[model samples]
Target: MSEQDLAGKVAVVTGGGRGIGRSIALYLARAGADVALCSRSNGEIEAVGEEVRALGRRALAMAVDVAEWEPVESFARAVVAEFGRIDILVNNAGGGFEVTPLAESTPQGWREAVEINLFGTYHMIRACLDDIPAGGKIINITSGMGLEPRPGNSSYSAAKAGAHMLTRCLSLEIWDRGIDVNDIIPGLVATTNVDWAKDRSSVESVLAEFEGKSPPFAPSERVKHPDELGELVLWVASMPAGGPTGQSFSLARRPF
Candidate 1:
């Protein structure tokens, strides 16, 4: 808040309607960047867009489904036309429709998982690559489930794993372009998608339930708020040229 570190930069954020995406977009806007954000929900994204404008930064809100190429391509074109260039690209539109084990999961749901989580990230990068100049940044939202194995959520695990590889490969291919590509592993965040927070009335309640001994994680592990991720993203985005690329910045204390 003290310094407008991202001033005059143009940022494009997918899944900007809510949760982590919304927090990232707002953080960028607060740092004085213009934002072009999209999600499937018109009203939700529009509301976020208004908030950006209120922060005295520009906003372009669109209803987009990133899993589809045509719309994403069109959105990229529109962003270039409206904002001139994109200094930051955040690929955040993804979720697992089927968390069931492979046998119990419908093929439709499994494919949906890959299409949105893996293919969607690729689509955004391909669409926006040309418009992103040197020194620009592409941040992919990744998951620990991708780096490891998930018993009941194989589909999501595989999809995120694919995305993680894509991030690394793309970094090697584009490092010469002066564009830094990396991933952010958010760890255990208290979003609506999380089981513990889904039924809980507040984040406080969720934290209380997990206090002293959070399951599936070490007892010392603590759940994070979406804003914590926003702050982490800002730090990464604020890094100067020649910083770490092809690396996954993890919030979790996993040894791996």
Candidate 2:
């Protein structure tokens, strides 16, 4: 597809303040789409919005906690008020605690994980469902652990897995309405979200260990860069009407 495919379009990206979300927002802006960036942090969202404006596209940055329905709804209203329409939705905000043994996991930890990864995504999708017109796109950012069991990170893995299934169900329900829903199961990506020094001395030391665990045959043969995933998001969102939908795309090589 060409960059102009998204020209004059409007997209809302939750967690668009930094990391993969930031890249996706910028890519959409570069593709000529007016973008609304939402995150819990106003400073980061505003910064990315500035970048979007630099790309010559209309940008709105709002502080939104996607887990809360009110903020999510307010953000949607704000975007519509400014841009007059919503053409795409990227459910990208997510959070998780460090891996802990299932036996030791607390109810609070599991609840937070479910709230952020699953409920947050649901709120965004639901709030924008009617806003996105026919032929619109919805991309849910999932994780590789969502596909298979993540022994230590059980709460996060379970929530993301449910989210992946949620994407498929939404696609089926909305197919006749021309709203396409799909998901991206990104492998480990280098992001500030990572707790690099939980046990290691520094980020550099942690990164060395991470690099050693990298999968072969993967694009770049290492953990993905945030912008690399962003490029894929742009492609999926801009794909022609007949392009793939209701699919789970993995960014890493399949172990089997």
Candidate 3:
């Protein structure tokens, strides 16, 4: 698709204040889609909104917690009110609160993980379903942890696995409406947020460790940049109707 192929389309991205979500919002704007972004960080989302507007596309930024249905529903409504319709929904608001073995993981930690990752995705999709027209696209940003087991990431992995399954189930349920749902499993993407990288003293240090480690299966493994992931998201959103659905695309160094 051309750079402006998404012209006249509207998209909503959760956790769009920073990281991969921020990149996705900017890329979608670059592709000519008006974007609505939300996150708990008001300053970040507002700054991203400015960046989107700089791209000559309409933009809306709101402070929201996707884990909470009320805020998500409000966000959806606000987007529709501002843009008139929704064409793309990227569920990217999630994090691993505590990476510990299942036995050591607290009930609250597991609940938070699942609610933020899986339930948040569900709430956003449900809240925006009516606004999204036929042929709309839903992209769930999952993780390699969901596809392959990791020793200390049980809670996070379980939540992401649930999200992966939700993508397939929702794809089938919404098939008649012409909406396509898919999951993206990104592995070791380089971003500002790297709480898990305790070994690295800085972001650059973390990235350096993965330098020249691009996996054969992915475009790059040397710590995939956020924009690279945005490119993949744009490709999926630009697919022709009935092209592909209920599929999981993984961009990771290790095999799943």
TM-scores of all predicted structures: 0.93, 0.90, 0.92
lDDT of 3 by residue, 1-256 (tens): 5733999999999999887898999989999999999998799899999999999999999999888999999989899999999999999999946778888989998899999999999999999999888989999999887878778878788999899999999988999989999998777777666654434554466667567764343454557667888888998999888869999887776678
* Weakest lDDT window of 10 consecutive positions for candidate 1: 195-204
Count of clashes in candidate 1: 0
Better of 1 and 2 by lDDT: 1
lDDT-based ranking, best first? 1, 3, 2
lDDT assessment of candidate 3: 0.87
List the candidates ranked by TM-score, beginning with the highest.
Answer: 1, 3, 2
lDDT of 2 by residue, 118-223 (tens): 9999998888787888879999999877887757889898899899999988988988878888998767677777653243453344456666565332434465
lDDT of 3 at 245: 95
TM-score of 1: 0.93
Please give, for residues 68-127, the per-residue lDDT of candidate 1 as tens digits. Answer: 999999999999999999999999888865867788989889999999999999999999
